[model samples]
Target: MFSEQFNVRFYETDALAHVSNTVVAGWFESGREPIFKLFSPNLDLRNWPLILASYKIDFHLQIFYGKPVEVRTYVSRIGNSSFETYQEIWQQNQKVASGNTTLVRFDFSSNKAVPIEAEIKSQLQEHFYPQQESAK
Candidate 1:
């Protein structure tokens, strides 16, 4: 799993003095940056974008400003032209929210879904779960 740590800012807090629900989405997006960088060191996402197909978020606890947060992300499933990722946000060592996102592999030139390349899959696998020999 890939993870990132960040501090909740005052601006991210709502009238309740807790992090806003929308801010959790932004935190999830921030966690995706390193995962995408692993696929291509110099990837220009604007050129070859992975479009979001669907997503779900479950909020468990309230997050407050000045608290340190950690977001963990991992690929849970990979399909022919799409992949699903699971993300969790933690504050004070407790789960604050969890989310899942489905992204479609697209052909920028054609502007449509396309099969994921083998090389790309291999790269993602290496970063998310490196292969290990079975114990005998």
Candidate 2:
């Protein structure tokens, strides 16, 4: 798993004085850039698009402004044309929220889903959960 630290900003807070749910989602997406780069350094978000097919976030605790948070992400499952990412947001060592996202590989030129590349799968396998049995 890879983790990144982010500070809650004043503007990200809602009228209730807590970080908005949308802001938390943005942080999760931002953390994914580096992980995607690990598989393809030249990954062009404009050319090679990965679309979010589904997402779920469970809010455990409220996050306020100025709190230090860590966003940790890992590849939990990889399928023929899609993958699942699991993420958690921790505040002061306590889990504030956890999320799961399903992303589908796409062929930009064809504007349709495509099977995941073998090379990309191999790279992602290196970061797979330790307890997961190796893919067949």
Candidate 3:
């Protein structure tokens, strides 16, 4: 799993004094930088190879300012042309939120999804997470 810490800024809070829901999304995206680097080592936007397919966040507790938030990201699943990242935000030793994001490897020139190459897939496996099996 990849972990990143960030200081909560006052502006990121809402009138209720909790971090805004929208802000958590940005944090999760930032936490994916490591995975992004695997796809684009130099992070060249002009030749970006991945596209965000979808994301979902579930809040467990209110996140407030004055504390650092740690985002833990894991490669939950890797498919032929896409991967899913499971992330969690923790503050003051408590989990504040958890999320999942799906990103597709794309060939922008052809506007189509491309299979993930073996070399890169091997790298991604280093941070893989064992997802729980569904109940019968």
Candidate 1 lDDT at 85 equals: 79
Listing every candidate in turn, what is its Cα RMSD in Å to the true structure after a full C-alpha superposition?
A: 3.5, 2.3, 2.3
Question: Looking at model 2, how many pairs of residues clash?
Answer: 0
Candidate 1 residue runs with Cα over 4 Å from true position: 127-136
- Residues 1-136, model 2: lDDT tens digits: 7789998889999999999999978999887876678545798666765888998999999998987899988888999989988888999889999999998887778889998889888877766655564544
Query: Model 1, residue 4: what's the lDDT?
Result: 94
By summed lDDT, the worst window of 10 consecutive residues in model 2 runs over 127-136
User: lDDT tens digits, residues 18-134, model 3?
Assistant: 999999999999999999999999999999999999999999999999899999999888899999999999999999999999999999999999999999999988888755222
**Highest TM-score, which number?**
3
Model 3 CA RMSD to the hidden true structure, in angstroms: 2.3
Candidate 2 Cα RMSD (Å): 2.3
